[model samples]
Target: MSRFRKLSQSIWHCQYHIVWVPKYRYKVLQGAIAVEVENCIRAFSEQQKCEVIELNVQIDHVHLLVMVPPKVSISDYVGTLKGRTAIRVFNRFRKLKEKPYWGNRFWTRGYCVDTVGLDAEMIQKYVKYQQKKEQVAEQRDLFNR
Candidate 1:
């Protein structure tokens, strides 16, 4: 049921469900902080050309289902998302500076990532059909010219 993205030479639908927690798993994400965290992730994902299919900000952790391009690195994306959001969150909530987190890191070192896949047969068939559709469209345009 997922949609595929077409590139010049590739078509892909790479998605992942990712989870991570705050340093020490503190229950600090609430109210303003929760909203800010969500906004920050959305903005960052847009800048990276990634799509956030779903997101949930809990008091101690976050769950994000994102659709990323095949060319992007999963580890790099998660790192950037966490690191940049941490800086922005800290800047907005200066009181958090008082927290005793080592090196002032917001999120923990490790995270969870799982791929989202549709039925293999369905994806193969869709891609196979898409190629033919594109070829027909190209031929039609040539005839119209």
Candidate 2:
């Protein structure tokens, strides 16, 4: 497809929608903190060879849509991204470490990830219809018995 990304040996198109929250889902991600966080994500993602397609830094959570190459694992990328960004943000704003529940951590333990591909709705509908057909077949078999 035209949207495929080329690698040294492969061509693929893999996009991910990731969501993560700060420690305690605090509203601290605003003003200066938000700006620093955005900078960290952008810079770190560039290092990891991930393209930031879209990013929304909410007060309590962050939503990101990114294109990550197949050579990199999504889990590892998210983990390192969180870690590096936390370090940068804390270094920039030393007072953040003194806040409640800081404990030298910026983000929560894990994140939510989903694949972004073609026609998810169509696939979902096809699965639902298949399930209905199976249910009907089972009912007919039970009646026949």
Candidate 3:
């Protein structure tokens, strides 16, 4: 009975930290593209009926800290998020249609998802910091160049 209970608990109220990269690691998320990606992420969360506690969209990858309901599968959730956002972003950005950005899929085939325990605050801080860290890196790279 205890084992069954543990299994059931695992099925419910699970938190997932997912990361997916852009195809070929293209750094297309610049200027207005980042804002569009943000909006698309919000829309995806709402449409999928999932709770996105934290999300950070970098130039080549996205970090999402989300809670998955018992009925939803992690693979499906990631696929939907990536697919929908790609479509929306491609449609909005004309330049993306040419190459590197829209010539192929927006996201890579595989993603990283980690099951997390109860540490919502820490996860949120990490997600927020990822964005800041990426921005700083970009600035530093530009300065160095």
Candidate 4:
């Protein structure tokens, strides 16, 4: 079921599907470390007042479906998540600090994000059709020239 949150001035439902991986895509996210990471994510989401719709922690990456308020910037929110989790995990697991690959970073500098909603497919189709329109526009310009 879809849910909407209400604020003093506005009611909204803003959701995003976010995916990110650790530095060097290491398969170290397993066993106790994975559990700790998952817990950290849940705690941080609560602190941000964001709802965790769904979460999947793979050996090398994490997939999260979250509902955040409109006031929150997705990039900033993602940065917070990555930064906090990294610090907590490293502190909790000292051995990780000694790993050459880990160095001084936990997550990579890049991440993938997409808005999620009922009209996602429709939006995708619309964007796909824009390419054809651009092609037609280019052709018309060539003919006119």
Candidate 5:
């Protein structure tokens, strides 16, 4: 399919590389929590008419490559994504909302966002490349065995 998306007024391809972590840089995301975060992000993207090109939820941080419409600002999108996902996660995992994570917050106050240009393919690769590398390593290990 074409990378560009069409609206009534414009045809555009705007991708962003966004990364954020839990409050205090905590590595609380894993297993079911990581899975839930991925689902929440996809749900959020769909709600905003955004496309998730790549998403990787790690123990400590999240990497997302998304094609966002021009009407939506990156900061606003990220803020909403963080806020909604935090609420969802915290609600589902009540124990997480207490103690170190005060104020019912899950993610940190800031996130890193960069616009993806013509090199979006490379950027997407970087977004979720760890899994490919690990799979290749596992294959090599199997061959050696």
Candidate 6:
């Protein structure tokens, strides 16, 4: 095996950038709802023995940057994170109700995962920028209407 691959395999410190949107991009999450979601993320991180470096919760989507052990699969980690958060958020907040917070599934089927390198600032900025862009688009839509 390549030395780099061997070294990566030996030392498990992988930063994952994951994003999941609500089933229909509903504007159901607000205020305390966002806080609950953040809490859930932290809980999941603890459960998986991972560290959440940063998180950004928007009205319809969530962005998380976490450092996880190599044994954890990205798919499984994301599934658990999304599932746990959705359940906790819906349960704690009345606004979610039964219809909009989640359909058959809490999160969309797929998520984006990017592995971070020595310089993770770019990824952090990108995630932050995503939320800003969405806010801009939302404001534009409101004005247009």
Clashes of each: 0, 0, 0, 0, 0, 0
All candidates' lDDT scores?
0.83, 0.82, 0.79, 0.85, 0.89, 0.77
> Candidate 4: how large is its RMSD?
11.1
lDDT of 1 at 42: 98
Worst 10 residues of 3 by lDDT: 1-10
Model 5 misplacement above 4 A: 131-145
Off by over 4 Å in 1: 119-145
TM-score of every model versus the real structure: 0.78, 0.79, 0.80, 0.79, 0.86, 0.77
| Candidate 6 off by > 4 Å | 1-9, 133-145
Q: Which has the greatest lDDT?
A: 5
Query: Cα miss at 58, model 6 (Å)?
Result: 1.1
Candidate 1 lDDT over 2-63, as tens digits, reads: 38988789999998878899889988888999999999999999998999877778777887
lDDT of 2 by residue, 62-136 (tens): 777788999999999999989998998899889988877789789999899889788544433443354356568
Top-TM-score candidate index: 5
RMSD of each: 16.4, 12.0, 4.8, 11.1, 3.9, 4.5
Error in Å for residue 135 of model 6: 3.8
Off by over 4 Å in 3: 1-11, 100-102, 135-145
Model 6: weakest 10-residue lDDT segment is 1-10
TM-score: model 5 vs. ground truth: 0.86
Candidate 4 Cα deviation (angstroms), residue 91: 0.5
> Considering summed lDDT, which 10 consecutive residues are worst modelled in model 2?
119-128
lDDT of 4 by residue, 1-145 (tens): 5478988899999988788999999888889889888999999999989998777777788878788999889998999999999999999999999978787799999999989889655544443454466568889999999
Candidate 3, lDDT over the whole model:
0.79
